[model samples]
Target: TESSTAQWANEDCDTQKLPFVCRRAGSVSVPAECPHEAQKPGKDIIAPGFPIHGIPCEYMLAVDAKSLVHLEILALEANPNIDFLEIYEGTMGHNLLANLTGTISNPAIYITKSANVMRVN
Candidate 1:
């Protein structure tokens, strides 16, 4: 069930009438050969093998616990229908903070809520 605060609870789907979101896979596939890396602030996270399609990379960013991370997307070039960049709030990526795709005109900003760690995939 869904609460008045807009949070989901453990309940049968038929018990409540709530709107849900779904995603369908497109023609593009997830890159099989992905290289993982751990990064600190100030390092640029770029997609491996730039200009090549079907290439994806994962990165973990850790910072001082007392500080929050500020992520600025300098540039993004991809087909919005297929490619995407997802930013999660923690190492496990249980909470999604941002999903970016397609061409970006200006720099987009994303900051941590409380955790000093974030995952990019």
Candidate 2:
């Protein structure tokens, strides 16, 4: 219901559409508006929304890392033990935290496909 643009196709939404619009983009921290409740994937997940690819939004904000204003630093749920907490791909990286100290968890090893497969002897 947040997508004011979805209701109309190529028509000026200002005349007949609601102000709220849902523009879904990948790895984008800030979306146009919160995704529609019906099309929502799940709760507590920040990036849970219907992805509208190949499209852009009229109203979107960008907060550059270098230009972010420092109002005040706040404490999080974990500290001292927590090295860093980043909001990646619109989702808080809580899943990675749980597996940090387990056998199945290897944060150091990342999965990558290399073109030179025959290099390994």
Candidate 3:
């Protein structure tokens, strides 16, 4: 049985082919709010509502255009599948520096290839 976007339905046993519906563009939009924006050399950024159930959030770190940004993962603990932290070099469209998930016991350091900006989400 077919249902609306906000609802689901179940149908009895039947042998039938269902036509697929396709869309050209996307519809859903998630509001990404970056509470932590840092420019310092050694800054610590904790995920919003960290160590607890985190809400949808974003974090952006920008440094001087000529100076590269270095990121160190001092500690990390999260569900690998559901929660993740993505590090990008320039913008979100640029090179992906690292895709971090799960818990990391040892400290990990990353230096951006580009010097302008780094995004964390």
Candidate 4:
């Protein structure tokens, strides 16, 4: 229903060819150290050894008590067969939020549903 009042629906990813944006190299600087836990906001989290062999890494993001954390995936590129990113609800991996693989066509956003803590692995 491609009309003035179209509703949102899921479609086949393999069939659709949507336009995307690409950033030029050297536009953004990669951080030197990857922290295991994060409390401050606006810190960019990059996969260990990105664009190459990405080693296994885990990170946690926590906000002040009662405040929720919002994670935004600005860019995600990975080998769907061998790479993945898992997000958890709290300080542990018991509650799975999202498991992402393959290349992301657009920016993805995830908000804390029940708490102010989030873990990424």
Candidate 5:
């Protein structure tokens, strides 16, 4: 089921099977490597076409092996219940640092626990 505001609808939790729809803003191709635009500090990772629709994006932020990467969400505008930002320590399967959703009133900061790799999805 689709609504004006993006949301998850469990039409039938018992017998209905629904295909997952993934959305992305713009025509940008998923890069084999991290995009250069996301490699800088203090960069904002706004949803591609924010305030309209949010697409599924995977961001891998990597730094020098000896250095640490810090991620801060300066401002976020999205449905807290449906759209969210998942932060992992190293990769997607690694330790989850935080699951951020909703309008962030206070800035959230996360530091990598191990290695210089942080995955955001």
Candidate 6:
């Protein structure tokens, strides 16, 4: 599923996997509030782990924690028109939601903010 869900930087974001998770590998510095694993919606989110051995532009979205619930933020090789997003809550927990209806690209994103999903870039 990680292969089929995985999408290239310029490809459609309708699937669950992406080659790059953000502008570049390790784009976001996952804070302590939001971890790369299952997260608690009502509590402070830990930052995701920065992609390891990242290339200049090539990005990666890897699981930092072992859980079924978590946001796997992928830095894009190059910032594109991120109008759509493949929200994989992980395995069967994943879902595809347009940024218009989905959450922002930020790992620290929370429902406390505007419920309307927006583009992070």
Cα RMSD (angstroms) for every candidate in the order listed? 16.5, 18.2, 14.4, 11.7, 12.0, 15.5
Which portions of model 1 miss their true places by more than 4 Å? Answer: 1-36
Candidate achieving higher TM-score, 2 or 3: 3
Q: lDDT tens string, model 5, 1-121?
A: 2422343433553565556444433443322333445556555665544444456778888888898879987767768688778888886546888888778878778998776888888
Off by over 4 Å in 6: 1-37, 44-78, 82-85, 88-90, 93-95, 99-121
- Model 3, range 3-121, lDDT digits (tens) per residue? 11222223333554445333323332222334543546675665544333366565566777798878889888879877777888876647888888889889998788855777777
Give per-residue CA lDDT, model 4, range 54-107, as digits (tens). Answer: 667778888888888799998889788678889898986788889998899788
- Show model 2 residue runs off by greater than 4 Å: 1-61, 64-67, 86-121
Candidate 5: C-alpha RMSD to true structure equals 12.0
- Candidate 1 residues 1-119, lDDT tens each? 12222222344458766565433323233223555546656866655445444477777777888987788898888888688889998788888999888998799898889888878
Q: What does candidate 6's lDDT look like per residue over 1-121, in tens digits?
A: 1221232234345774776554332233344223334333334322232222212211123333432233334332222453333343223323332233234354433121212221121
lDDT of 5 at 17: 56
What lDDT tens digits, residue by residue, belong to model 2 across residues 1-72? 344234323444578576655433334343445444322111122222223321211111123433321111
Better of 1 and 6 by lDDT: 1
Order by TM-score, highest first: 4, 1, 5, 3, 6, 2
Error of 5 at 34 (Å): 10
lDDT of each: 0.70, 0.26, 0.63, 0.73, 0.68, 0.30
**Top lDDT prediction, candidate number:** 4
Overall local distance difference test of candidate 6: 0.30
Candidate 5 segments exceeding 4 Å error: 1-38
Instruction: State the lDDT at 57 in candidate 4.
Output: 75
- Estimate the TM-score of every prediction: 0.66, 0.14, 0.63, 0.71, 0.64, 0.22
The Cα RMSD in angstroms, rounded to one decimal, for candidate 3 relative to the true structure is 14.4
Q: How many backbone clashes does candidate 6 have?
A: 20
